[model samples]
Target: MRTFLSVIFLAAFSLFSFAQQPYAPAAALPAKNLAMFGRGLYPGNDTTYHLLKRSGFNTILLSSFYIHADGDLYSGDSHQPIIHQGKWVGDAGYVKRVKDLKTKSSISRIEILLEGRWYGQPPNTFDFIRDWYDPAKAVPGIVTGTGKESTLYNIIKVLKEVLGADAICIDDESVYHSPSIIAMGKIAADLNMHMTLCPFKRNNYWTEILEASDNNLVDALYLQCYDGGVRNEIKDWVQGLKPAQPIYPIFMVRGSFSTCDTHKGSKSVAEISKQLRGFKKDYPGMSGAAIWQMEDLNSFVKLGCAIKQPSSGTAKSVAEFLSQLKKALKKEL
Candidate 1:
């Protein structure tokens, strides 16, 4: 009889425990805040940083910090304000541009895109920045956690102290494993740097990522609503993650003049607003929308979000763009 009672008691306890778990969110949520991504440099656009400062996006996820083969992270060269040494330098003047932006406006945060090396780019071209996270190399210490002594941990420090990064965006397309994803979040949290994940799928990997991280360390997930994830429904994606986790549906700014990628799926400004609102209706806590390349955004996403920006095609300078955007936004407000 005691054994029978014990079984019943255990089963009851299990049921109670499951019932106590937090509820998954439902309902479309408002966009948390608008955001954008950009490479730190452009050929002739010296005022790129200044223009971005006035663009009114809450955060800017800079394109990227390369994870090395072993476990180290590349934080530019030894210089205090990292400047690329190589000639065809992709992220050249990263430190300086970020510094410039902070000086200009009060955008919420500036972050780094921790991405794997591109498939087409030759390994030699990336050696200067050590950009090589792949299925083979994997993310060395992200899951298990990295301590102060760890190179990856120090890289976080370098980002905070040197570049003044307010957060770190985990764009780990290489390894979607939960352990590493969780570890990366924990490490970034320990350093006082906010962690945001930009995931491509709505699957078990993300579910586990939130559950293992306890959905605490990660501030948001920049869901790629466009590009390969175009078919991804924001409502379902939001439900897949914990209710507390903010989601920002990021769209790709495509076309010939577009700087993000060659993938072209041009939606009108009205369509973008409708899709974003649909997500908000289903999940109210959504942070907002984000565009992949700020430079390529033109006026579609900006206008949809009510962020008045420069003319898509014009000979205007960055200063002129900022001036006009400010005036436009002031009138709208």
Candidate 2:
């Protein structure tokens, strides 16, 4: 009888220890890569995917997934929804292209960005999550039936099962509910998917989430260093978050919002390269950086940024832009 009691105690203790393990940062990407975003990627064809495959980017981030009240998912301004009533209703060809982009090219990580609006956008993704999540019915590391019924769980599950996404980037700009995000993180972990934070500010909010998860749930911090986040400093974030994971600064390149000039947080290639050098100097531990989007890059290539037209066609011009950007990422400053 004593032996049986001893066995039970030991098993309980073992489980406790496993649950209390501290967060160890996940391994950094082997090489610096760009995160392609915007409407350009959604409608990409063989030619587009082909260019991206050889574009030298190892990671692609599909931006701004919004969740409706009925548990449907939409990317940006597209009329068609990606997920409707917990089922995938998006284009199959888009999925095929993504799969091919991952399997056939250098891309290894595909992350879907979940964004909330600043204002006026009713029923935002984060807002829905905050409103729907009930702590009383929540379980640690398990998605209950109630959870499955919720739009949050279904949306995340679809991202994992259907899209096979490696991670979900939390771009919760408007909503700042800690519990909702923490709950989502748990669901993400339960589904074998990692979560990353995209923060322009609110270090305390992010820090709380990291601490609550013991830093295990969130693997990286994609710091937005463009537009509203232009004033964000790497050193400040590093000091504030004390994150075990690497932080990648996202830069808004030229032609953002279809403008050629460097206004509104858009920077020229040379300007970006120089800014990167400065950031590297400030945070020597910086491991990676990301371009704001493919839309801006495409716009810049298609229509010159206050200069002469691109010397080559779209594909070639885009390739050259990527090559230059990659070099900027790799070259020693």
Alpha carbon lDDT of each predicted model: 0.55, 0.75
Task: Please write out the lDDT profile of model 1 over residues 58-98, one tens digit for every residue.
Answer: 57777645644433454322212232221112344655677
lDDT of 2 by residue, 1-333 (tens): 999999999999999998887544332244455555544677467777787788777788877677766657887746568887668888888888877877667777788888886244766888777867874555443233326565577788888778778778899888889988888887777776678899998889999889887455687789998888988888999989889888888888776777676656777767777888888898888878888888777788777643553322222377777777777776733
What's each prediction's TM-score? 0.65, 0.85
TM-score of 1: 0.65
Give lDDT: candidate 1, residue 157.
Answer: 70
Candidate 2: regions farther than 4 A off: 1-34, 118-120, 135-146, 306-316
Clashes of 1: 19
**Pairs that collide, model 2:** none
